[model samples]
Target: MDHEKVNILLVDDQPAKLLAYEVILKDLGENLVIASSGREALEVLLKTEIAVILVDVCMPELDGFELAAMIREHPRFQKTAMIFISAIQVSDIDRLRGYEMGAVDYVPVPVVPEVLRAKIKVFAELYRKTRELERLNQELEDRVRARTAELENSTAKLRESEQRRSMAIAAGKMGSWDWDWITGDWMWDEGQYRILGVSPESFEVNPANVQALLHPDDVDQLRKAIAEFNSGTRSYETEFRIVRPDGEVRWCVGTAAATVDHSSRVVRVSGVTVDITERKRAEEQQNLLAREVDHRAKNALALAQSIVRLTRADEVKAYVNAVEGRINALARVHTILSLSSWQGAELSKLIDEELAPYSPSGQIRLAGPEVQLLPTTAQTLALALHELFTNSAKYGALSTRSGRLMIGWQVDDELLTLTWEETGGPLVRTPKSRGFGTRSLLASVESQLGGQAKFDWRAEGLLCRLEVPLTRKPAATAPSKFDAAAAAELQRASG
Candidate 1:
């Protein structure tokens, strides 16, 4: 697309032939350089770049073959297209030699004007494309270099600003202290006494006096750090607890660097101390909450997947009803747990939520101790209770206005056992098939809560019992324990 001028070199020993070659190619509208001999053509080539060369094979001295061979030796002309034109009919051997010497085409003259024009036109277009590509590539490199330099400048300025900020924080918030290695004299900035929770006149500024105020648990570690610094470690840093005169304990981190004399003797030790008890407490709380959230999220997702897998119905509406009911049951338990900061949920509160719908008819009654259930246990039991409630409302005792339901639980040692009883409705009969709700209730009790379940199909009503652990172990934090195979199966099923 670039309309840059391209050169076509024409070489011949005869003036008449050169004139005729010029006349044939002038209509192409490109630069045409003419030379009387091969030597003159080589001289012209040395001064300017050309796209194609048309040379006479029978030129005086420096023949076409010899010139082409010489041109091929130059790195710049390696890809330049060359065509050899001979006045007399050339033999096959001469034509082969011209090709071996880098000739792209050979023509016997009386040359065909159209053939020469087409060949020169192809090379001229190729040269123009090559130049355009080179220009684009150079521009891309320049942009990359400029952007890289800009990033480096930004990074350097950021590092400078960070250094200044760190210096300012150290000066403003920390207590600077120094000790002389030779005289054993101690120095304290006004901030150091405030950090120690003592008036300047009340305490001596000496290593022994300071060590006396350190908590017993931290004294040995602090002493070791000081010993290491005095023995040529060049620096000291350690965190320790100190007890003030009022018996209040505070956590402090101390840092010191040693300066040595030219004679290789320690000269001075200097550094700062700052309180970080609040930061450490905050970090601990954050880690605990993070672990709790991760555990709850994973368990909730697994529960949903299980519910979807276990629920079965012939119609879409039936399946949707079953899944939504179970999810709402889980949400009811979560609402109670969220109120308690996820510590534990009261058994009475959990029962009220699951049985709230049936309580208006006076058919549902709950009696239990003031037991606190862990978050996981509360969720699993809530789902199980909802399934039982649904069955009673449909086919069991609660279907009739006079029917009665009683739930009770008691704790013994490490286990808590619950009993559910029904009466005053149509006679209970053992069903031929166990539905999804029955299986899900049993599975939630046994597998998720690490509990056991039993059912009795008495003629008066249906009776059920469940036993679960009271204190559940906290969830693990490491990701390696997250079962990848189970997650993959869940993903496949969802897909």
Candidate 2:
């Protein structure tokens, strides 16, 4: 707690001699530690900060020279001054040995208090100055660390700005150019060189050089836009085409702003160009798809109208039901084709939908490859399958608990051959007269699908075989959906 007191340690084996040393150093006005032996002195040194230590030459264990050597070995005591006292006459060799052991001076038994006080005062002052120097050095180091952190933060912010600018240019597919209108000098970034398919060394800096690569049709419009920009009438915004060095044509949209002098005269122009060829192509495709959808919708409506006309019933309800079923069949096929982007419909899927009412039944079995049918064939076949399923559910294989049906198909070149057989049901025979459903089924296969169908009546059941063309092209036919057989069949059914 006493900041002004410097610790001075005195070591002696005799209590009387320790008393004598203490009385002499009492006038120094410092904290004094007295140890009876060398061992006691080391214990005091561990707990206290000593400016100086005085030791006696004669002791029982660990005499003055040995204690001084131990103290000098400690890094904390590197600056501690030691003094040795002896009652006997000392030789030159003994004094040299004592000094080598870190003793500052050797005093005889007749001690002088003034000389000892002066030596202790010098070392005490040195310790105070050393502590102050350490405090100043620490303060300087703290300031340097704070300044370095500030510089690092500033550098990080600059790097972040550069990264964001680079990302913006890359994400927008944009290239920048700056031109001095008066000097006809232009500077472009690497992105600009890539956009034009030309290296910087091969590119001319003049505006006319750029105009030469403009598409023939877009040259006039681009020139007018540039003229307006130069006159300060309008800010530059235009879509044009450019032919690159590799002879590839690309669509480009550009925006520019003029840097004017104090007099409002345009001196420099800077702008960005973005490649828009993919966007333009996508728009064109979208428009074409829209027009195609419109045309297909119109044709579908016309076809439905013709189907309704061709479809006849005994009364209003029957007519509505028949038309509704037929249209639903057509719609199902349309859905299948639409899902595949009008590529085709899968044969297995078409059959599964028509036979959904009889699903999970052991009586019906369908097997075939995943053959794809053209849209027209799929539509015609969907209607035909609907009628066949209806007839079987009413009077054929699907009508009895034990009835069984099997349908399978195989592809041969451009023809898909399908077989339908019924078993475990009442014997089927040729009908007395063909019904509307039967006639429609036949007409759909033979005319609409450009296919052939034959029905055989046997004692076991009825067997139907069909061969359909797998061509993607639609079957050519007149607009009329009515045929002589369908008309006759409708008349008979109505009666």
Candidate 3:
């Protein structure tokens, strides 16, 4: 206990009594308030809490007896213990009066200061203990609240887990099983009975009954996978067909892993079986797509080759490299399309990625608003733009070291326009080829983009123009569409 913090009140009319009490309690290191009258003591009590009060019984106006009586009357001062102080001896009636006024002890004056100080010490220690108990109770309450919060979080997680289990069993068409070796008990998650087309009450889970539903042709592999499971030789994995009594055969992927006993023998197994008929159909479709894409890519290369052969000048390796480079650019676009399962490519992302080689230090400038096109629109535009860029590099404005290329686009109410202009090369000239690049570039862009094109061979440069319709039909807003942040980052990097 901090004795310095305890307050002692001395209510006496005599100045000498007040001084003596202060001197004794000063050595006890407690705060002391001396009240010269009963009224002063009541004022002191209202502002501060005193652990103990020493009252002088004999006084002129409102004496110690009256003060003690008033202290006992108020609920605010009920816990204060009063020890009566007096010089005169009291009669039986006065002693009875002191008891009625809440006096526990009396000290005859001149007061023994040590006795008074010792009595004050007892009450101060009790105050300290009471405060400690309150603090402990508050801490216990906080801990209980924290524990309750943790339990609520755990319960919510358990409910979410049960919900997830129920949803997967409902949606995934899976069957589950569990076995206990020691107790010889079997349990199945709800999905297990559903996939087997059996009710929970109807499922007889013995090994032989479970095997009855398997197709006859798959018996050997099923037996092998199960044998490995029972002997602990390997993890279980097998694909088998199940023929229902109605002659419907469904494919399933069965897998299990063993739990071992103390002797290192296989004691139990737990696993799931999933119906894979739909997945198998999807795989077949994927194989067909792969073959189709391969055929298309080869045909594109062959067509480019025919264009190069028909347009070639004798013994010029530069022309050959040019032909192959154009084909390779188209192939790169095809590769990106394949990653999307040939669904489509984003028009803007396709342009930026394909034009990167020509922009070396990103000296070429490009910016536009935005546009979206179907997969066919994307391929046609990619091939057409590739042809225009190749020609500019070889014979038009971009042929010289200081040449600059600027590409831009805009959209108005009913029209979209794209322009490609080059500067600082040798003066432009007409292309000699009526071959694939020239003919294909014109036809594809005009017909496919719902656009027209014009080529100008100027003295200083070459310029090409495009106009496409803006009233495009709505498309599904696939979330896999190009992320704008990533596109802007690429622009900043290239710029």
Model 2's alpha-carbon lDDT is 0.81
Q: Give me candidate 3's TM-score against the actual structure.
A: 0.47
Weakest lDDT window of 10 consecutive positions for candidate 3? 474-483
Q: Against the hidden reference, what TM-scores do the models get?
A: 0.48, 0.60, 0.47
Question: Which segments of model 1 are wrong by more than 4 Å?
Answer: 1-187, 194-273, 471-495
Across 221-326, the per-residue lDDT of candidate 2 in tens digits comes to: 7679668966675368889898987799989898888888898888888889888889999999999999978776765675576568787678999889878877
- Runs in model 3 with CA error above 4 Å? 1-4, 58-62, 73-76, 137-175, 178-189, 195-263, 272-468, 471-495
lDDT (Cα atoms) of all candidates against the true structure: 0.82, 0.81, 0.72
Ranking by TM-score, best first? Answer: 2, 1, 3
| Higher-TM-score candidate of 1 and 2 | 2
**Higher-ranked by lDDT: 2 or 3:** 2
Tens digits of lDDT, candidate 3, 149-264:
99999999999999987776797568888876556678887787777776767667766766787888988886787577666674778888887655777888988877887878
Clashes of each: 0, 0, 1
Candidate 1 weakest ten by summed lDDT: 474-483
